[model samples]
Target chain A: MTDPDEAADRRLDANAAAGPLAELFTVDLTVAVATCAGCGNDAPLAAHLLYADAPALVVRCPNCAGVVLRYASSGSTLRLDLTGARLLTVTLAADGSVGISERQPHRPP
Target chain B: MSFVSRGFAGRRRKTPPGRLPPGQYDVGDGFPVLSAGPTPRTALASWDFQVQGQVDGVRRWSRTQFQGLPRESVSVDLHCVTSWSKFDTRWEGVSVDTLLADVVTAAEFAVAFSDGGYTTNLPLADLTGGQAWVVDTYDGQPLEPEHGGPARLLVPHLYFWKSAKWVRGLTLTLEDEPGFWETFGYHNYGDPWREQRYAGD
Candidate 1:
């Protein structure tokens, strides 16, 4: 299986923009399992949490009946090229590093 | 019962499309609240995206210019903070990494402002993780404005909101800013694995 990040990158490379949003909105499937964290004495969490504005869904652990709260990761940001948009400068360490220390509006050259 | 049995395999089962995962992620949160409505026909020809702030110059693109730009396709799971995992969502757009490939930026953090005025801020590392893209198509179809059509940001790793709909433009900054939901009490780094839905999340 492709790592999640790598898979997403490949998708971007292969298709400019496809049906990702619809898939997100499309109600696809449900895995019957412990809904609550306390109820199930499972080794690890089987269900993942995902939400948007408010609580999307919740289920109780039948045994312990603990509430399991799930929400989505708000991954949003801006990307730019040095010539097209504003530019930021910062020192990147030896490790594969990228960071912004300062910024100024970008001007088209 | 047999219908469900046939559809379900292992721990997974089929669900109705266009709706949340039935009992899961279904809170009657209502429409036009968290998501957008369908796109207008005129929107197709008139739609354009503006890229501003922390850049060399303000940039704007008509639907055509956007289409003319380099394109990419990616498939990844959308881990909503709401607790539903939709895997293998295929997206297409200009690779944010590619767009910013040669740009010189000094902003400390980047924020995405959407059409609904919804905003999500995060560190630059997340956006350039070699995966982010300015998504224009979803599943081989043009994105309807209701779904942030014309153009929307696709950050499969984070909650769908990070993938702002009706994404008019982008602004890079040096401060860690908060957005509409973030101000009300949403997590800064909404990681599904950590269950960070709200402040202190």
Candidate 2:
């Protein structure tokens, strides 16, 4: 088997950013669709790469590696920056479920 | 002049007295692995470290050549912007002074770039006078990829983000540049003692 530690070899879900993001949004952010400003590719916020090893959590667009969102806390204050995302929209799942659903076509309009 | 909640108590860590900087907690031997991007694994045969930009000329070294250079064993405290401070962590690598000894440069700023396109900016003075190193070993083991292996820049005095991991080269500039976190909201100069963890603070 290949070295399990090799980077650029594996990808992670939004589990890392989900917890911190949950505290901010009442709705599940994992199901939200973010259009990458860099390339205009649309993907779920959960499918994006969450670089959690740094001082702050950075969510990057997997398509172009553009930063989609950044969140950090300083003492009692929290800061969030979203410059790489052109648009953010919530997409509901089948059977009226919200998050963690299988990928499906985004709703019309 | 504040009132306390009826059943509330402040959250505090039982840290060893006076050892930790403000708002920091001792991790107690567990060196946490944190990264802003995916870990990069470079082959030693193709790996090289360089110091370029604003210097008289670029300096390059292959993995074998760098390993042959003089190195130092350092035991220093590491303070992360996330309020975690690891004390007396051991590392082995060549100092920035040693690496820049032969190079001629008048630049006052430097941007440490890593293999995975991660970059962190610092002052030229911060990289000199034995303040920083490009380390490859931690705790007597070849540094792991998850923790910036094959050699990562070590600048312990500042927040760990300034010490770019998977560090590959330094690009010096006359003007100070904002790095990954610095461009975000992280303090420009992360001094743990002063608790400069954010841009304003």
Candidate 3:
């Protein structure tokens, strides 16, 4: 079996890719809430495991290891994939402070 | 437009004379090993390759049986989504066409499942026509486990993550299905030239 500590050491949090995501969106992507389409797990993007060693940024669900988002930027062009996410909710506060809701919104009857 | 930070610029080398895709830097020698999971130690004796799902029937191959299949050597450029491109990487393996020659599938997509439960999906069209291979040797050496030894998918045109490491089998599907990284947020169809690394691209 592989060493758990070593594996953890190689992985980075989704926040590490925030700079690229911030360039595309007005708010920070790490603060956004993402729902994983694979395992139905909903959490803040910052909580996801991110692998940044490649030419692209790969974000996977901490629960199921499913890729949540992949962002690649080349020059002025930026590619963002959110197919693995059922939904991403980002709230902008009037004060300009980005608000990330930890709890997933309850479905209305 | 290129955001090569001062620190990153310090590490930059002169671009080679070939046609490289945008935002890609040439990294000479040494293919980096990056994995999202533990490197599985799969013994050859216990290793088998399978082709199933959306096919007429399941096809299986033992290690020896797989190596017995027609082999081809290819030299191709590898582009990782991380912005590094390795040129003229040579590999030897059976083409996906050879592996699926006997199996008839109406499936439009496939999910490459690997030893460590890692997976990446690709369109069925991408696996044929000499586009992809199940390579086991790199630079004439048996692939090291860290580098997805035994065998791994090689789809050079797309981001390297789409070329899953430690590949074991492919599950064909009538509809598109996201693999391990795809489920997290990787693009469904990764075309590096178009920079289709993500969904919006």
Candidate 4:
């Protein structure tokens, strides 16, 4: 159940998950902009809340408390769930700034 | 071992003595509050626990009825999948054994579900005997909502996620269906001693 009125925890943010996600994607996933499927709130993953103690690294939208990403690893197996993210726009400029183009998942809206 | 980044700024995680499990640091005196969702505020009047699925009949208990059941005090260690453990914490609650005593069931697996739509899978054996409880009090005080008030499942032997917070009920199942975290790659049977934090571990 996604609660739009959920209060975000002040102590934790996407930076807590940035390191592990960087290891997984080799690029900083927190730098990408994720649009929340629950409420269409567009924010950088850095603005999301990290639920650090879960079995997976759960990144939830700050606006709706809906999970935006779930990353988990067990030994050699790694899984990433982006079901809650409606769109992810990544900018891969050499300076790592400026959105030249946006890459959303190939799923219909 | 946990996948901690460089300069991980987690606080108060000091290394405790031999009482700790592998890859775990003690969060002494600090009861860490970590949840996948917002803390649910279920009032005691509306709160009820049920034992259903694969049972002969669903057994329901109102809050007053559950509180009236046989209660026991427990002192146990809690190991989180996040690689932190708290030692010798005290809790009071009705045992799962006592709750299931009158219910007839031949199910082999169980899924403990909570108020905020969280669920975790467990072998029925892990939930039976004196191993688990539906704890309502912690350190002799009514459990705080952040710490899963009203009642929460306490399976001290497994990693803390198996101890579902704001727990509402258990469903016995013939199939070993993975619940919430288990479907997401957490070890189905989270035995902290074996370091079963993830699925393939």
Chain B TM-scores per candidate, in order, are: 0.78, 0.91, 0.91, 0.91
Model 2: per-residue Cα lDDT over B1-201, one tens digit each: 989875534343355678799888888667787777667769989999999999999999999999999989999889887778887789999999998998887899999998878888888999999899999999999998878898899999899989888899999999999988888877888888899988888
User: In lDDT terms, how accurate is model 1?
Assistant: 0.52
What's each prediction's TM-score? 0.54, 0.81, 0.67, 0.77
Model 1: per-residue Cα lDDT over B1-201, one tens digit each: 336564334445454364343223522222233331112234567767665678776667788887898888888666565566565667788877766665567877778876534567877788896757899888899876556677788887666667776776668787888764465456787766566766775
- Computed on alpha carbons, the lDDT of every model, listed in order, comes to 0.52, 0.82, 0.82, 0.84
| Model 3 regions lying over 4 Å from their true place | A1-109, B1-18
> Distance from true position, residue A73, model 2, in Å?
3.8
Candidate 3 local distance difference test against the native: 0.82
> Which consecutive 10 residues in model 3 chain B have the weakest lDDT in total?
B10-19
Lowest summed lDDT window (length 10), candidate 1 chain B: B31-40
TM-score of chain B of 2: 0.91
TM-score-sorted candidate list, best first: 2, 4, 3, 1
* Model 3, span B39-120: residue lDDT tens: 6789999998999999999999999999999999999989887678898889999999998998988999999999867879
Error of 3 at B8 (Å): 17
Cα lDDT for residue B126, model 4? 95
Chain A agreement with the truth for model 4, given as TM-score: 0.74
Candidate 4, residue B49: Cα displacement in angstroms equals 1.2
Q: Which portions of model 1 miss their true places by more than 4 Å?
A: A1-109, B1-42
Docking quality (DockQ) of candidate 4: 0.32
lDDT of predicted model 4: 0.84
- Candidate 4 C-alpha lDDT tens digits along B1-201: 778665555554655567787888887777887877767779889999999999999999999999999999999999998888898899999999999997787899999999877899999999988999999999999998889988999999999999999999999999998988887878889888898887667
Q: Which of the CAPRI classes, incorrect, acceptable, medium or high, describes model 2?
A: acceptable
The weakest ten consecutive residues by lDDT in model 4 chain A span A100-109
